[model samples]
Target chain A: MEKTILHLDMNSFFASVEQAANPNLLGKPIAVGGGIKKGSVVAACSIEAKAFGVKNAMSTWKARKLCPHLIVVIGDMTKYIYISKIITKMMVDYTDLVEVFSIDEAFMDITKTQDRFGGAIELAKDIKRRIKERFKLTCSIGIGPNKLIAKLAGELQKPDGLVVLREKDLPTKIKDVQVKELCGVGRKTEEYLRLLGVRTIGNLNSYPREKLVKSFGMAYGEQLWQMGQCHGASEVRPYFYETQAKSIGHSYTLPKLTSNTEEINGYLLRLSEQVGRRLRRENYKGNVVCASIGTGDDKTSSHQKKIKDFINDGYQIFKVAKSLLAITNKIRFVSVSVSGLLHQLDQISLFSHVENQKKVLAAVDKVNDRFGEFTIERAAIMSTGLQGKTGMVPPKLYGLRNFKMELRGIEPLTSRMQI
Target chain B: MVKVGTIIKVGVVFQGSKIIPRWFIWESRKYEVRSLDFTWEESQGLEKIIRFSVRDGINSYELAYNTIQMNWALENIC
Candidate 1:
């Protein structure tokens, strides 16, 4: 049976949310990003801003230079994540096979379920309308026989777009499209394909598979061949399946560059606490602890050490990370991470007193969870002015269970607003 | 842009669930909030701060409430 995959991508997600919340910014050029600080980068830009050559990841300084009137607003990631979750719940209502591609994009296998809603187009229209009515935001939806074609079709148009790429229409639809436009053909791959004189999907389709395999590896070459033929995996996994995290880490950029070792170590302790808390919360332990530092001149160095005992205690992780810091001058950024993760299991140990340590950490976590983070902190961290500082975590599409649980009891302020 | 860390008095209404700012008194003058544009939370060390992007007729202001300090500040105005 042929698969029917639908890709839904929110348009100008962060900026669109901002505009939706504020009517005055509807048609204005706005970019959602960091503070108005000098080196801040634009995380997302509105279509109106993009018209003036503004783009994501471009420095705010350069963006302002391009569009003098560009409104730069600091991003509210929690709100965006909240909205993303609500949208995901809506998608799950249509089909259980929903794969969240990103915070603003998802792929749903409505092949078997579309008939209930008349057809694929009808289902897409209904979902789009519901989102618009509820959040006052727009999204583009693409329907195809597989994930790749559906995603590419969705990217063909802009905000509030719907495109369908049937299997029979694949050759004509994608032949003229740039090979770079296909998913997985990034900058380096594009350059390599260009070297092979493969500029378009048609060109890639005509190229010899043997040559492709000889140039690239077997797996990637075959993947490219299939992509050129507009073929992709149709499986859409449920988000409830827990994907194992390879590593857990946290980092913080200092408000000011400092050479004081005590201050840097203080920051390291805080980061270790965050990483360790997350690891314990997720029921994972690791043997390797890594620490990294970024200097003012844009130089960064990192070191990792493997310990004999697997651990998830903050102080233990901090001790390892502090030893690895190497005491550098002019440090602007500090980070701590742990890898070599293993599922945590309760093991009876007489000498280690591990049970007592676990109990102490649990008590601390309970207090902090009820009140707020850093409510109870180490005495050493008290003077560093890093007690309640929250490091930025780039929003993830699937692993939002913890955040959702955190906000469960708190009434969302958006629900009470008149908008 | 104004300088950082300016404390101000803000009149807010607690509507059973969450706190909503209606107006703020900055520099001895009151600016009534026409609309609540956006709201988000931030943390400064152990202090959780709630920020609001609000409009007052002709201009927009960024106001924040520090839960630890139990005070409101006018963060910015544009």
Candidate 2:
């Protein structure tokens, strides 16, 4: 059977949520961003702000210059995640085949369930209506035979748009669209395509396959050909489907650029700990540790090394990352990540010290998992002033914690924030 | 906006699955909830919490209810 996929993309998600929560911001030009400091970029902008040529990912200063009256609100992950979860739940009510594309987007395989809800268009209308009524937010939904075309159709409209694109409609509906508009085609690829005189999707379709393969290699070239025909993967993996993570990493931008090794190491340790905590929580141990350092001049240096023994301890990860760190200029950003992951094999350690360290780490993980992240901290981090600065709590933690509470017939603390 | 992660007293009504905050006391002054702008739930360890973004007409405040403790706390003031 031909697949019927619906792609739902929230319009100006962060800014919309902010406006809904604070009525004062409604209909006003607003941009959701981090601290309005140097290098801070607008994460999302309201429709009012977009009218002034403000775009997402534009620097906050530049956005402010474009719309001087722009209300710059700090991005709040907790509220956004909450709203996203509710929206996801609503989608699941229609069909179990719901793939959360991002915090603000999802792809649903409504092939089976659409008929039950009168049809795909009816289901999409119901979803849009419910969202608007409940949260006062709007979303653009596109219906197509596959994910690629559905997403493309979604891009054709703006806030509260609903578009349907059948496979037969592809040639007439999107032949003139820019080739770069197809997902995954970056600026460099567009430039290369332009060199081949393939500027539109229609041009790409007519271009020789052998020539595309000769220029861009077999797999990518073939993928481009498929995209030109508006063909793509139709499988919508549900949210509950567990996929093994390829990497676990965290990075932090310092308040100010610094050349001090101690300060850099302090930030590195904090990042490693975060990465290590995530690794252990997911029951994965990795051999490769990657370190990235960003300089004040907008240059980044990244290095990764594989160790003999797989480890998930924060200090061990930090030691390996610190060795990889070789900085020359004043650094502003630091990152640590672990890759080459495998499910942690349960085995007794040969070294007595190593065994003790494992016990200590397990205990720390338990406490932090229950009370909050960084409930027990290292003496070194205390000196760094990053002791109590908690980041966003992962959704898995909330699910697990909520499950435990419900199982025990305990009243869940509604406002208990781990962040 | 002020982040006040302190405990405060509040009056609430549990209507079916909904939790409505009536009024809250912070620094010995009572502020009645004029409207609840938004509400959401969160969890920490084994504790589940419900948070409300409420306006008392003049200013907005974030109030949280800890069902396990059967208590209310003011989280933020805006």
Candidate 3:
């Protein structure tokens, strides 16, 4: 069976949103972040700002030095989230099997239904047109057989570009392009591959899988080899019920290192709430909680607690991290991370001591999910102020038993999807 | 260790003033307490400035942060 997948990405998301909302910012060198004194940096930069050599994540002070004319805007995450939900709605119109890959990216498995629609290329064109007409924003669309290929296609072009890649065109189109440009390829991986003279996708295609796996992890080695062949999976399963986290931790960088235990605890409470909210949203609860701190000198120390059971909720997670921080003096950075997750279980283990807390958290999750997130955030987090708002970051790992077999039927995994 | 006077820029997609030295930044908000990858030259005035970025009205505080701390005579540790 042939699969057609479509990936959509908003261009320069935050800055673009600012431009969309305010026409004046369109041609200007605009940055989205905190005011100068806020110690924030530019999260996104407009094309005009790019022209000035300004870039994302550059300090506002440095950005100002780089472009004195640059206009800065404090990020409005609420607005972006609103737009993201709307975009998700639009994606579902094309295929129910859509995976919200990131806040600004998604993959829609259109393979099984491509013949019913026009074709991969046509669908990509239509989706682009619809997005432009509806959102007044530009997006890059990539059409391919698997998520990896589809993601590659999306980046092949940018800012209202559409790219289509098929097996037949891989050999010719895959050459000349640097392998580092591939989705999963990063600085470390690229350097390692380059040492072996694997500079392009074509080069990787000829590399041995066993050797690659020995060097890279089993996952990356296999994924890269598959992507090299342009034969990755086409299965666009409904977004995974188990969301994998890139980093599962909460952190706060103090204005400077402080001995004030209250200030440190304040940050911990805020982070715990944020992490707990995310765990419950995805039906995951964690068993490992880690604490880390950074002194203003850029050095860090960390510790982890392996709990007998999993729990999710800001107050509890905060208690653990705070307990650890209580012993550390004059810390500059603080973080709380929970890992080793299990699906939300209905049956409470008879031996557990925190059942009452779990019950309270469940109610809170229901109310917040229904009304709006943060409708009932931890009171301790309130002092972090408006800027300390949290998000549904990636969720922690859940065990095999956590996955429901019923969801597998929605989309079958394929050869192309595996990589 | 990132020290005062460190001209450290976390994850910079590009240098603000020009394309020659600009690059993308990846450091996160949680990093505000410490200076991440920086050079000796970067630390020259690192003690005198606080830094952050704004994008499309959003802030990447952790990824992009710099600030100068008041100069306190260094206590040479063994």
Q: CAPRI verdict on model 2?
A: medium
Candidate 3, residue A197: how far the Cα is off, in Å = 2.5
For residues A17-123, write the lDDT of model 2, one tens digit per residue. 88888776889999998757877779899999999999998988999899999988877766777788788878877877777777788999999879979999999
Please name the candidate that would achieve the greatest lDDT relative to the true structure. Answer: 2
DockQ of each: 0.21, 0.58, 0.01
The TM-score obtained by model 2 is 0.92
Between 2 and 3, whose DockQ is larger? 2
Steric clash count of candidate 2: 8
- Those runs of model 2 whose alpha carbons end farther than 4 Å from true positions after fitting are A391-419
**iRMS of each prediction:** 5.2, 1.5, 20.6
TM-score of 3: 0.69
**What tens-digit string does per-residue lDDT give for candidate 1 at B1-78?**
344468998899999977889998987888999988767665443567887778997777778899887999898775
Residue-level lDDT tens digits of model 3 in A222-310: 88887777767666656535445533555666655677766677777777877777677656778788888887666788888877757
**Candidate 3, superposed: residue stretches over 4 Å from native:** A208-211, A217-219, A240-249, A253-259, A278-284, A295-300, A326-333, A346-419, B1-78
Q: Compose the digit string of candidate 1's lDDT tens values, residues A187-278.
A: 99999999999999999888888888888899999899888878888888666556777888887666677889888888888878878888
Docking class of 1: incorrect
DockQ of 3: 0.01
